[model samples]
Each structure stands twice: as C-alpha cells, then as structure tokens.
Target: MNRCLSTLAKLDEEGYSAPALARLADRRAFPPRLEFTRADIMEIRTRTAAHMSISGVQEKISLRLHRGKLQPVTEDGEYILKPIPGLALPRFQEDVPANENLTMQLAEQIYGIHTAPNACIRLANSELAYITRRFDRRRDGTRVAQEDFCQLMGKTPESAGPLYKYGASYEELGQALRKYCSAYPVELEKLFRQIVFNYAVANGDAHLKNFSLQQTATFGDYVLTPAYDLLCTKLHLPEESRLAIDLFAEDEEPESIATYGFVTGADLLDLASRFGLIEQRARTILNDICDHRDKARDLIARSFLSDEAKVVYQAIFDERLRALEIRG
Candidate 1:
C-alpha cells in the first residue's frame, strides 16, 4: 500500500495531475513513466483474486500487482483503475485539486448516507485515477448481475445528452428505488443526504451513469451501489448548459442548475413520497444538509486546492446551501 501511494504521488509530482490528463497534454510539468503489464494485471487478479475483465476503453482498467495486505480490492472482487488521460487532465487543470478534494469529502459524506466502500487511493497520473472496490461480486467469485443506469433505462453511453438523458424519469427511477431500497425512512434520509451532498459539493456531473443499481441473486433484488465517482466538477469548470439530469417529469430541455432547473422541492417531495418518506421527513433531510455547509467549507479549505479555487468552492457552497435553506 505504501509503495502504491508513493508511486502515485511520484506520478503526480511528475506532472500527471488530473487536469493535465483531462486536457490530454502536460501543461507545466511532465508525467512519470509507470509500467503496467499483463503479468502485473494477473497478479492483481490472483491476489485480490477477483474474476473480472477490463470491459471499456473510455478509461483504462488494470489490476494492481502488489497492493500489500490492506486488500484494497474487495475479497474475490475486481477493482477499477482509471488512469488519468493526458488530454482531459490539462483541460481541467484549474479544477484538479478541488475535484480531488471533493472526491475525498464525498466519501466521508456518504458514510452518513449509506454503506459506501472506502476510496482511499487517488492517482495523479496523466488522468486522475479513481480506484474503487467492486461491490457486484459474490463471496465465491461469481459476478453478481449489474446494470448501468443507462442500459437499464434503454439508453447508450454516447447517446446520453449533455444533461443525463440515459436513464428513466424521476418517477420511474423512484419506482425502482422503492423496489430495491430498504423501504425505511432512515434509508430515504440517506438518499436525500446524497442528493444534498452532490448539490452542495457542486458535482454537476452526477448523471445517471454516476449512480446505478446492483442486482444480487443472493439478495434476490437490486440495490444502489455504495456511492462511487463522487467528485466536484462544476467548481473549476465553466458553467454547463444543462443540469445533471431532469429529476421530475418536465420538458426535455436542458437545465442550468440541477436543483432549481426542472426538479424543485415539489419534485423532491413527490419522489420522497413514492419512496415512503413523508414531506416532513424530506424537509428534515434538507435541513440536515444545510446544517453541514460549514463542514463542507472546512473540508474544501483543508484540501490541496489553490486559494482562488478555495474561494470559489466556498462561494458555491454558500449559495447552494442557502438556496436550499438546509439547517443544522
């Protein structure tokens, strides 16, 4: 684990920052050369002993050859390795530190929402690397059935619009949630917390693909995966033309802000009702999120972000939390 961390840190030092990789070019620094091989991949698979194969090309997924005894990857499960791409990194350079910071903060926030696996290692390579424990695996090594939100709702990755268009409407999603979730107010509260955390962190990228339902044969149903890929992209990026995705049954137009755009408190209330949460419970969830604004602010300040970036983050945090009127 120490070696892995050291290697990642060295990669970041050599200029493989997230922004640089997103932009696909080195800006003020050069990236280090870390060798990834088939043998190393095999070792990672054997040790973590998870049976899975790399399935996509948009991002590269490799097995970790030597992760020590920490068992970074889950037992008999695969791990995802997203190397920072050269081009995309530079495009998002200014926001890199903030994005990374948000990822860490999000992991903590989700602890209050649901049982998310730990995401401790973030690589500073040509592209920002996010490693996560694969939850869609059984104790023995069978791949539990899993469906990307996009595919489940009959959409493709590329066809996904600027806003998230690859999934079912909020109404449809709510139905699914009710079927899969614990059907308790406490669980619903956690879901609300997740929504608030995303908005508070300015994670404009929380589209359908970002969240998914995992189908476990043992459990005989689908459930939300512990949150993964939780990062703040809006703070450093330019204003987007659309919200992450429409949450209610609104016009199919793009939205500027996620919360206020098509989905309002009314929409949230509707969804909550379907999920078995009463209006007051929903309000309580909002209030709890609002109360955490200061904590979010502090987390941003403590990150490796620049001063200018920190101020930007603070401003966004204040505006969003205040708009929602969340109280401690």
Candidate 2:
C-alpha cells in the first residue's frame, strides 16, 4: 500500500499513480504538484474568497477541475477542496485534511455510514487538501435543490438567534426529516445510524449546518444528503466535552455530560422511537456499530492521521464505543 495518506492507489517504480483520482475526479492526472508552497496555497485561498459560502473558519475554495487543473470557481463549483486550515487549534490544523479523509472513509467503508465521497489530494506545492465531490450537483451541471437542517427547521440567525442552528437538539433534526422527507422511515434510520457513527468517531462538530436534505431524482422529494465534514473533532479540541449538539432536547442527563457522561444506548433508543423505528431496527443499527469496532480500529491504524492524532482518535473511539455499548 502506498504510505501516502491521500489516496488508496499505490505507487509503482514509476511513481504514485492517479487511478483513484481519475475515477473520483473530473480530471485524470493529479495536479502537476499538490500546490506545494505556502505562497501557492495562499493564492488559491485568495482566489476562492469570493466563491466560498460554506460555514466554518477552515480556509477552502470551491473549484472547477478543468483540463487537469483546479481552477477557482465563483459559481457552479463541482468540488470543494480544503487545505489544512490556517485557523485551528495548535498542531491539529495540519492534520485535519487527512483526519477527515480517514474518518469519512472509515464511516463509508467500515461502519456503513453514508458520507460524501472524498480523498486527500496533493497540491503542486506539496500541500494536502481534502476533496469531496458535490452531492447536490448533477452531471449536466445543474444543482439539485438541497437544504441544510438549519433551513429545514427555519432556524436562522435572524429568526432564532446567533446560536440558532446549534440551539436545537438532534431529535429536532429527526423531526424535520420526518416532516420534509417523503421517505421518512429510511432516512430516520440513516439519521440515527449517523448519530451513532458520529459519536463513535468523536465528530464533535457534526452540527446542524453539517446535515442536509438533498433532492433525489427517483422522487421529487427530499432525503438526508450524503454526510460531509465528518472528522474526529476531539483530536483538535481534546478538552471539549459535548458532541456539537444534544442527542435529544433538554438533554441535561448526567450521562450526556462530557468526560463522565455519554450519548448512551438508551438515549438513542428513545430517539429511535421518536423517528418510528421498530425495536429490532434500532438494535440492528446499534449492533452494527458495536460489531464493527475491530474493523474501525484496524482502519485507524492504517489511517492517514499523524501518530499523535491516531492516538487521540483511537482514545475518543474507545470512549464512544463504551458509551454506545452501555445498556442504560
């Protein structure tokens, strides 16, 4: 296996191949150099300033991969490329792209958590950026209508408050899914599974803005969008306790407390009932997460995260695994 954390494709005597990149991206060849220098990356970020509307402090630019080169796009971007964030806690900034790539792959490959298809892309300047294909955009270059949970719930900074998106519980997200999605039962289960997966991986930043309802062609209705921004946030914010938002409203239970408390199995069961999942269905999702521990651990070992970050990620996983397994 290529030790390079960016893509699964191997390097031969010639060099690292672009097979994975070719398959996933519009362009076949990797950027002549993963934009290697600070000056080059800064220039890309500057060009992207007008195009980026996504929330968060991470410096990223939406790009149109044109003729084997990533060109900054002010509109209709097909891919979002994020470099190691310039503004993040300490040492973790540099590793976040790889951390997210590893986490997204783990969710998709090991735990069956549907997430945005992503890979680590090397810049010509030697920088690494996490690149994910846009799930909302279609082949013809028309965008599928999609709304983040925040929009679905009518929670805007003007309407509710500055913290509006984070103010609601995860249960509220399920409620919105039920109301908006024509395929409620299935989406609800996916939502529940995602919560467990998020906890198991310590994605403390899986906030409302991070979840969306996308329009699928089979029916002119909404469904949970492919998961994105799924990184182990605990690696960066080690002291942070809460998992972005509450699992349920008024989730003041002692067990939900950070460090000592957790989003226990019972809490999930209760939420599952709210979403109308039968007992067996709920257990199946929980059991899958429990059963996949070894697989998850194995991937973490082979993950692209730095050695120190791997330890933190694994520790967070262990803590969440214990929380998910508890009967109460």
- State each model's C-alpha RMSD to the native: 9.3, 2.7
Runs of candidate 2 with Cα error greater than 4 angstroms are 1-23, 26-33, 36-38, 250-260
**TM-scores, each model vs. reference:** 0.65, 0.90
Residue 293: error of model 1 in Å? 2.5
lDDT of 1: 0.50
| Residue 280's lDDT in candidate 2 | 88
The model with the greatest TM-score is 2
Q: Give candidate 1 regions above 4 Å deviation.
A: 1-58, 65-77, 88-101, 107-111, 115-128, 138-140, 157-167, 179-189, 216-218, 250-267, 270-276, 326-328
The C-alpha lDDT values of all candidates are: 0.50, 0.76
| TM-score quality measure for candidate 2 | 0.90
